[model samples]
Target: MFEKQQVIYLAGGCFWGVEAFISRLKGVNSTEVGYANGNDLAPTYEKVCSGKTGHAETVKATYNPKIIALDEILESFFKIIDPHTRNRQGPDIGTQYRTGIYWQEASQRDTVIKFLRKKQKESSERIVVEAHEISNFYPAEEYHQKYLEKNPQGYCHVDLNLIDDEEFDHLTKEEYEITQLSLTETPFSGKYDDFFEDGVYVDVVNGEVLFSSDDKFDSRCGWPAFSKPISEDAITKHRDFSHGTTRIEVRSAKANSHLGHLFHDGPGGSPRYCINSATLRFIPKQEFDKLQKDKY
Candidate 1:
C-alpha cells in the first residue's frame, strides 16, 4: 500500500552506520550498503578502501514521498555528517569516506541543489559534499549488507537508534516526556525561562542547532521565547488541535522531537517560539566555536 518509491545514493562515511541510520527513517523502504561511482568494473571493499577505485562507501536509500519528503531525507543526511569536511566523516579518513548525494531522478537535482544552498548559507565554511546524477553503483559484499543488524556491537560513528522512540534514553525523564510525548512543561518553570546566555540552543537528542541567542527575546510568556529559529527550515510547524484549541506546534526537523509551539504575537509582531527548556541543550559560544573548528 506504499506509493511510488524513489532512490538516492548517499555516501556519508562508513556505509554500515549510514545504512543503519537511513533505513530506520519513517519513509524509507529499503537500504543497501555499496560502492558507488567507481571506475572499476567490479569493485570490492578492499579495492575501494584503498582509495584507488574512485568509489565512496555509500548507502542506497529507497523512500516513499507520500510518507517522507525528499527535503526531510536531505536534512537527516546533513544531521549525520559534516558537509564542510572533505574525504572524511567521523574518525574515517580517505576519499572512500567522503560525503556525497547522488540522485537518479532528474527532477531531484534542483531540490538537492536548493537544500545545499540553504545549508551553505548557514555555515561559514564551504560545503564539500558532492551532489550529482548517479554514475554507477555496485552492491557491497554479502557480509557488509546489514552489518549492524548482524553485529549489534559493531563499530558505528552514528547512533543507529536516533530515530526510534527508545533512542531518547539519554534524555532526562522530564525532557523525554516533553520531547517524545508532546507534553508541555510548566511555562514559568523552565530552566531557560529567565536564563539568556550568549550561545545557541540545540536539539537535546541530536545536537542539531535550532535557535541562537541573537533571535531570542523576553516575551514574558512564562516560557523561553524566541523571535525566530536559526533557520526557517530548522524546525517544522504543524497544526495542533490539542486542549480543544488550534495552535501551531513546532518540532525539531531532524530529531522529530516536540520542541514547542509557535505563536503569532511577539515584539514587532514577529513570531514567538515558546520552546521547552528540557527539550534543548545550550552550547556556549566559546565551546561551539571549538566544535566547529574540530570538524574541519
Candidate 2:
C-alpha cells in the first residue's frame, strides 16, 4: 500500500498563474488558491493586492508520491520562478507576490534546508524564498480555482511546455541523463564546483557508478578529478591515440558527454580520471540513504 495523499503549499508570483501551472501536473489530486501568512479571516483579492495585509497569494497542492516525489515537486518549483529575485515574479512587484514554501510537517524542514543550501551554492546568490510553518490558510473565492481554465488567454507567464510531469518521477530524465549519459557540457559553469567535496563521481548518462572519494584529489583543474573509478565495469574506456600520444577516453555506457580523459600518471597507485564539473550531480552520504529508500 502507498500513501496517496500529501499536501504542499507554494507561493510564486500571482495565484492565477501558479494555480494554472500546478493544476496541469500529473500527480496533482487537487489545487486551491488562497491567502497565507496573513491575519485576515477571509482575504479578498482586492485586500491582498493592497499589500497592507501581508498575505501572499498561495496555492495548496495535493499530490501522490507513488506518482511524484517531494523533491521532484521542489525541482519543478525552482524552474518556474527565480529564487534570486526578492518579493516579486516578472512584472508583479509586491510582497504578496513573494515566493515561499509552507511546510505541513516538521520532518520536511530538513529536506527543505538541504534543497535550499544546494540551490544557494549553485546560484551563489542570496535566496529570498521563505520556508515557514503554516499558520492559517484562507481559501480564495470559487473563481480562483482554475483561473486559466476559465480564461484561456489570460495574462500568465507560466509556459506549460517547460513543466514536464515525467521529471517528477523518482529517477527523473535529468538524473537518468547524469547516470547514463557522458554529459561533459557545462549547462551552467562555475555553479557546481563545490559538489566534489566527497563521494563517488558516477557517469551522468548511465547508472554505471564510478569514482570514489578516496580516489579523489585536488588537482585544481576547475573540475572534479578522481584517481580512478570504482571499477573498470563502471566506465567504458576507449583508446584515443589522437594528436600525438595514446590516451584513454572515458565515456558512459548509456550516453555521450565527453567526460575528461584518463591518464596513467597519478599520485599513489591509481589511474587519474579528470572529469568535467557539469557532468556530475553530488549525493552526500546522508542523502544517499534517503534516495535508496525512495527507490524501493
Candidate 3:
C-alpha cells in the first residue's frame, strides 16, 4: 500500500501565489510556503530576494496521489508559470523566484525524466525547466506560510485567472518549456537518453505512438530517423517554411508537435522520416513483443 500523503516541492514564482494555488487543489493535504534550493545558512528573505543566496521561493505540498497523480500536480504547476523563463516567474524576476522541481526519491526522479522526454517530443521548441535532487530545505519565516489565505488582498504577481485545469492535461512545466516557451534541450543535458526495451513512445500531449524502433533507421543525420510511422493514419503532414526552406512537417495525428521535416531523398528513393532526438521515446523491440503477447 502507498502512503496516504506524499510530499512534492515546487517553485514557480512567489511563494504566496504557489501556496495559494496549490492549496485549492483537491488532494493537497496542506501547503507550506518556504525556501528550498539554496546554499546559505538560515538565509533571510532580504538576502534571498537580493538574488545572492540562490534560494528559490518554493512550496512544499503534501498531497494524496490516489486523488491527484504526481503528473497532474506537475501539470498544474506548469500552467501557472513560464517554464521557459530562467530565474523568473510572472513579474517576479530572480533566482529566488525561479522554477524548479526537487525530487525526494529515485522513483520521483524517473517519473520526472519520463515526463520531460515526452514533453520535448510533443513540442517544436525546447524545454528549459531545471530539476535537481532535494538537499536541505529551510522553511521560510512563519508569517510566509499561507500568507495569501491570511491576507487575500496581498500583492501577488501571479495571474489567478491563468490557473486552468484544461492546460494541465497536455503539458507540465517541462512540456510548456518546449511547446510554448521554445526552450530547447533538457536542463540536465540529456542525462536520461536511453531507448528502453519496453513500452511505446506515445505522444506527450496525447497517447499516440507515431513511430517505433521497428521503423527506425540510421539516416546518419546525427538524429533518429524513421522510415515510416507505425500506422499511416497515425501521422499528419503540413507545409512548413519557418527556416527559410519550404518542407513538409511531420506531426502526430493526435499530439501535434513539430517532429521534424520529411525529405524526398532516402535510400532507394524512399521518403526519409527525419526526427529530432529530443522528440522521441524509444521502446525496445523486446518490450513490444511482451505487450503483443498480453493483448490476447
User: Which numbered prediction scores highest in lDDT against the true structure?
Assistant: 1
- Candidate 2 overall Cα lDDT vs. reference? 0.69
List, residue by residue over 109-197, the lDDT tens digit for candidate 2.
Answer: 88787888889888868998999887678888777766776687888866666765453344444443332222243533523444545
Model 2 lDDT, residue 150, Cα: 66
Tell me the whole-model lDDT of each prediction, alpha carbons only. 0.85, 0.69, 0.68
lDDT of 1: 0.85
Tens-digit per-residue lDDT, 1-296, candidate 1? 11356889999999999988887676565577899998998999999989999999999987667568889999988879989889989999999999999998999999999999999999999999999998879888888987886787999998655565566668898887577556678978999999888999999988999999998888888889999899877877766544547888787777777789899899777889999999889999999989999999
If the candidates were sorted by their lDDT against the true structure, best first, what order would they fall in?
Answer: 1, 2, 3
- Per-residue CA lDDT of candidate 3, range 1-296, in tens? 12345788988889998887876565554567777878997887888898888888888887666567888888888778777788877777888887888887777888787777877787777677778787768888878876865687997876666655474455565553333222245332331233324345655555567777666555655545568888877776665433346777665554445466688677897878866545555455677668778987
Clashes of 1: 0
TM-score of 1: 0.56
- Assess candidate 3 and give its TM-score to the true structure: 0.53
Best candidate, TM-score: 1
Ranking by TM-score: 1, 2, 3
Question: Which candidate, 2 or 3, would have the higher lDDT against the true structure?
Answer: 2
